[model samples]
Target: MTRLIKYAFLMSAAIALTACNETLEDIAPKAERQLPSRVVQTMKAKGMSKTSPVMMRIFKEEGKLEVWKAKQNGRYDVIASYDICKWSGQLGPKFTEGDRQAPEGFYTVRPGQMNPKSSYYLAFNIGFPNAYDQANGRTGKHLMVHGACSSAGCYSMTDEQISEIYAFARDSFKGGQREFQVQAFPFRMTAENMARYRNDPNYDFWKMLKVGYDHFELTKVPPKVDVCGKRYVFNSEPANGGKFSPAASCPPMSQPESLLTAYKQHQAKYDFAFNAALKKQSSSKQSETIAGHSEARLVADWSKRRARGEKVSRLPPNIPSPTAVAEAPEAAPTPAVAATASAYTAEPASRLQTALEAVAGEQQEETTTAATETPAAGTVPSPAPRPNTSPERTASVPAPEAGSQGTSLRRRIQNLFSR
Candidate 1:
């Protein structure tokens, strides 16, 4: 009986230990059941295996997630590219909590970071607030790439897409890769695009990101990433086998001479092309401004006349009826139109339209107020003039008599037209 009890206790303890040691996939089994056949086929096509190493790259602007797998030839080949269903925030790195900005940087995901029982289907944390982020004093948490097609500040893909991406990471981990890298970028770091946004506040940061981007582009290998001097440095070694510290001054470092030469040549070629593209973009913009100037002046004159209650020959054709404009299918931009469009499309047009509408609304409101307040013709009374409530209009319209709210409103409308 004593021997029997001891054996039973030992068995129970062994079982418990094994259960505790079970992996995420072992416990969840979803990836095991659904991913094996597809993963095997994909690996076979890529000349890889289930255990092959993997890396991911995400482009928020283009909404793409690409997975690359190591092949027998020791080169990484793109195994799959998934369309991101949705991602939150604008074209910059997340700075603080609740910023809703999906992070843009190099991250590493380890086995423990995988969440098989995620509310957003299977998910993996992208390891935000990395060394570079930390060095810069940026803060955020729980940034993930997951399924659900919705996000606050995460990269959300369809359930099917996440399944495959999750499987790739899982297999890589099982194949003895302890971690995989994820490179997130605002957009493709193309020279033409960079040149167009050169004046933007984020240009310097984007330029930094392009260093890593260029490294990968040149070598087709994942760059060795480290942080020093509060910025990311890639593919460099300390001058004499020294260790790197993220927040400290960068020690003298060296890169392969061949790589240095290749990078310089690449930069020279792109710089020339970028300058050419910039000249074209600038010339196009100047022509557009010149063409629009006359129309803008006409619109301003019309707005002033309408504000004064003067009869106008016609309204601007571009100023569509609110309902018609709302219902109209936006005309598909032709190639010519697209070529001339701003790098950030439709922004200038949208802003101008919004300002115009606001001015028109204010003028209408003032006109109604004036008509209601006009006293009986015979009554002579002086009331102190109302101040112009709209300060934005003051720039274009001269101040009228104290009580001339209608004139003030009209002036504001004219100002918007000028804009």
Candidate 2:
């Protein structure tokens, strides 16, 4: 009887241990994920640490996302550049709940917003519909920069790329930085691009963004962002100790005299550059205009282009391009052609050449782009094609008053500070 009881007890204990083992969860050790060694070496070389505060900038048109880390001097330096895997929507601010538009503006990310166990791998919310957006009555939720090469009104990055990015943010938070800033723009706010996009419906909004952009360009530091009168105000203080109200009229604002002087100097230079860019764009458009060309002449030119190895329309200008199976659909541009185009990408490209590149998929050898220009970000290379980046059922967003009121008020402030 004693032996039987002992055997029964042993069997029960064995069964209990097996049940416990089966019920235990298997978890991914994500929080402790470390930064890549190469990035660590780069930080060391750049006089930075893993714990330094970080900022991010995204250029939609350029398809670039840059990580800038603060150095000992408090100046930020570009530490990494990653091509956005995908971002949905047109090049504008998101307005509605289901627009599928990746937003463009400054956003903040706090520790609580980071999700290590994200369904899409790791992810972080870029607090959208901010004060300015709210003032303008915009609505959206859960916009994120996350892993998984997918986008649905979010900025998607590759798993490997996001691992490094997440590590950077995690390390910064660990070092006591409260939050980080993300500056998302349609493209690099360079004068040339500004001139190119001047006629766009979003110009006024872009102009407002430029003030904050210019502040950072001139100061090498993130501007203090505030929303007032339903617009973004950068690096300014209340003149009479009043507060800024997003909907109501703005209080009188002021800036440091020295900063104003610097801005005046900067603005003078930018104005000159902007005018030149505008003139160039106008001239290029005029030269490329095909509105008045005779069909015969267009056909003749088209023939010559086809002879020059250009993929051209069978019919004349304004006619639909060749869709009928004429020549096996020209089997995905040859490697040689792609290599040639990429090799000369560091050179400047004109609007016409850019159009041709688009038609030829930027993988063709023949193009007359521009003289010379640097990639938008340091060490950035030509952008790779991203999937699911096409705009979907996009609705027209109402232009914000920031383009007008903000412009006039910003100039008024500039004028005020100059004195």
- Backbone clash pairs for candidate 1 read 385-402, 385-403
Question: For residues 1-419, could you state the per-residue lDDT of candidate 2 as single tens digits?
Answer: 99999999867876776777831112236655788788899999998999999999999998999999998889999999999999999898999999999999999999999998898889999999889999999999999999998999999999888888998999999999999999999998888999888889999999999999998888878889999999999989998779999898889999888778998999999999999998888887764454223322433343344444654322211332122222324443344433433453221223223333343432222123322333555677677535322132011112224436445434432222122
What total of clashing residue pairs does each candidate reach?
Answer: 2, 4
Worst 10 residues of 2 by lDDT: 390-399
Q: How close is every model to the real structure, measured as TM-score?
A: 0.65, 0.65
Candidate 1 per-residue lDDT, tens place, 1-419, comes to: 99999999867876776789953444455655346576579779879987889999999888999999899887788888889999999988989988999999999999999998899988999999899998888999999999989899999999888988998998899889999999999889998889878988889999999999999888878889999988889999999777789999999999999999999999999899999989999999996785457444544454454445544334433332322222333433234323332232334466456555666675666669878888888998678576545554445567555777667656655554555
Report lDDT (CA) for all predictions. 0.79, 0.75
Candidate No. with top lDDT:
1
The per-residue C-alpha lDDT of model 1 at residue 134 equals 89
Error of 2 at 91 (Å): 0.3
